[model samples]
Target: MSGGLVALLDDIATLAKVTASSIDDVAANAVKASSKAVGVVIDDTAVTPQYVSGLSPSRELPIIGKIARGSLINKLFIILPIALLLTWLAPHFLPFLLVVGGAYLCFEGGEKVLEKLGWLPGHHEDHEEAGATSAEELEKSIVSSATRTDLILSAEIMLVSMAGLSNEHGVMRVAVLIGVAFFMTFFVYGLVALLVKADDVGLRLARGALEPEDNRPGPVDNIGRTIVRVMPHVFSVIGVVGTVAMLWVGGHLVIANLAEVGVPVFHHVLEAAEHAVSGAGGFVTWLVETLLSGVFGVILGAVIAWLVVGASALVRRVRARA
Candidate 1:
């Protein structure tokens, strides 16, 4: 009986070790997979703040929290199941899915570009145009809009990450995919919370530096003042970066997946650029690819945008005539 107990104890220890190792591997894979979707994540972070742009300061963080919660629920409940189903039942069709998602990113990014250029009228309904009649309704609209946007970006994040995990063991793939989803939600929203509240934080710090008798500024005071002034520029920079990232990632996805689906024209150009920049090292090659992808994304996106706008105008004209 004693020997049998000892053997069981030894077996338990071995199982424990195996479990620990598997958990570590899952974590490592999750990080790697999450990294694959960094561009989309950046786009998400950049785009999210716009939803709360004109809202009351006190309400911003809560609205962001609601959106974050919605994002997580959508990912865990809806996206995960559909993604798993597709991965299991129709793995071969994922490239087309990527192309669709990619084109969406392009359309969104390109629309913003055209609006900024004043070439397209603003179709996106802002706070006033949304027809929110009260505080509660307005809050709901903001949350709804932000969450809706997050759904697409979140889907891109999961699907793009999944592309890297296709060959992983089924169990491990599920674990890593789930892990990436959770990590990304928290990470992106956390950064957003910090960004939206940064000015408030700066104000608090500036207030603390109010020495009635001695108005001499301390280092913290200077830092606080600087933060207050810098955040606007930061937001502007983030917006531009996010737009470019969407274009580059979208273009890269479309062109890369096109190769997988037998249309390699764009990929061939990208590869040639990489080859040309080979001697300059990995960073240079990546830069060339990104710039080229951004240009391609913008062009493709503009064409799609024109078609969409023309169609909408035609529909409106037909309705008016009727």
Candidate 2:
């Protein structure tokens, strides 16, 4: 009886050690897979702030919270199950779906560019003015639009993350994916909440909310004022970065997946470009690749935009006739 009890205890110890090792492996794999999806992650971070840009300051964080919650649902309830099912049942279809998602990014990015260039019908300034007609309605609208966009972006993030662990154990893959999804939603939304409220924070500090009222002109005031002055410029920069990131990510996704599907022309062109610039260092090579990708994305996006816009217009006319 004593010998049997000793063996049982030893077996339990070994099982605990194995479980710990598996957890560590899942953590390491999750980090590695997340790095692979950095492009979409950055795009997600950059694109999110625009939804809350014109809203009232008080509602910004609440709006971000709602979007973040929706993002969690998207990743966990929607994308995860579908991705795992597809991986099990039809793994080969992922690249095609990625292409579709990439085209969406391109279309969004391209539409922004066209709108900015005055090629599209609406004036953004005017639109913003009209869009704010009702704060509640605007909040709901922004949240809805942002959530819809998050669905596509979240899909890409999960797919890219899973692609990194394609050869891993099934349990490990699912564990890592869940970790990445939760980490991304928290990090992206946390950063966005910060960015959206930066000006408010700066304003409070500029007024010396923490300092004694007698300290009329402290160094903190200067810091806060500078932040206030710089925030608009920062927002403008974020807008440009977000739009370009969308195009670059979208374009790269399409190009990379096309190559994966055996249509390697675009990928080969990018590779040749990289080779031509081999002596210029990795940064230069990357810049060249990005520019090419953006160009391709713009072209593809423009075509999609025309089709989408024209189809909408036609639908409107048909409705009007009825």
Candidate 3:
């Protein structure tokens, strides 16, 4: 009886240890997965403020809050189940979906690049000036528009985050995804709220406008002026950063997955480039890899964009003739 009790106790202890280890693995995997999707997260953060921009100050938080809730619904309820189902039913299709997502990201990034160069028409900025004649009208417009955008961006985020977790057990995979979904929605929207309010915070710190109180700049007062002065530039930088991140992440995803799917020319070339740069140390090698990926991404994106544009034009002509 004593030996049986000891064995039972040992089994219980072993079970406890396994449970603890599994929890830690889930957390570590969650963080790693989230890191992989940082590009989408950054773009999502940058894009969200436009929904609240130039709106009534009082309506901003409520608008952001509702959009955030919609985003959570998108990730937790909509995207999560669909992703799990795919993983279960047709695990083989994930790389293709990721390639599609990556291409979308690259095309978006390339659009920004081409738009900046005056080579492409932009429908993106036109979204901001849409009519919002009343608070209710504004809320509906912002919520619906932002949530729709969030769904696309959130889908990319969840899938990209889970891409590296294919080898994990099913329960671990689900837990990591759930953790990532919650954390990312919160992080993206939370930062967006802070960003939109940055100007307001700065103004209060300035104690007035961009200038300090009574022409005397205290540390806090100077900070206020700095933030107000810097916000426009900050927004511009964020747009650039988001674009670059998209290109890098998208390009890397495409290259890596192509290798996975038995087309490894680009991947081998990238590896060779990295090997060439290895003597410069780790950071330089990483930079070279990222730049090459971005370049490849832009080229692929431009080709896709051209095909899409051509197809659209052909369809329009056919419709007109019909």
Error of 3 at 206 (Å): 2.0
- TM-score of each predicted structure versus truth: 0.92, 0.83, 0.88
> Can you write out model 2's per-residue Cα lDDT over 221-319, one digit (the tens) per residue?
878888889988887887778788778878998999899888999999999999999999989999999999999999899889878889999999999
lDDT of 1 by residue, 1-322 (tens): 9999999999999999999999999999999999877778888888788888888899999988999999998788889889889867988899999888888888878988998999889765586545788999988888888888788889999888888886796788999988998899999999999999998889888879876678877778888899999999998888888888889988988998999999999999999999998999999999999999999999988888888999999999999999
What TM-score should be assigned to candidate 1? 0.92
RMSD of each: 2.0, 3.7, 3.2
Query: With candidate 1 superimposed using the best TM-score fit, by how many Å does residue 85's alpha carbon deviate from the native?
Result: 1.3
Q: Report the C-alpha displacement of residue 186, candidate 3, in angstroms.
A: 0.9
Which of candidates 1 and 2 is the stronger one according to lDDT? 1
Output the worst ten-in-a-row residue range by lDDT, candidate 1: 122-131
- After superposition, which runs of candidate 2 have C-alpha atoms over 4 Å from their true positions? 1-17, 50-59, 122-142, 209-216, 279-283
Most accurate candidate by TM-score: 1
CA shift of 314, model 2, Å: 3.0
Pairing residues by index, what is the TM-score of model 2? 0.83
Q: Return the candidate ranking by lDDT, descending.
A: 1, 3, 2
lDDT of each: 0.88, 0.85, 0.88
Question: Which of the two candidates, 2 or 3, achieves a greater lDDT against the reference?
Answer: 3
- The residue-by-residue lDDT of candidate 3 on 1-322, one tens digit each, is 9999999999999999999998888888888999998889889988999888887777888889999999999999999999889878998888888888999999888888987887877665444335866668767877998899999999999989989787887788899999898889888889988989999899898885433346766788788988989998888888899989999999999998888888899999999999998999999999999999999989988888777778988999999999
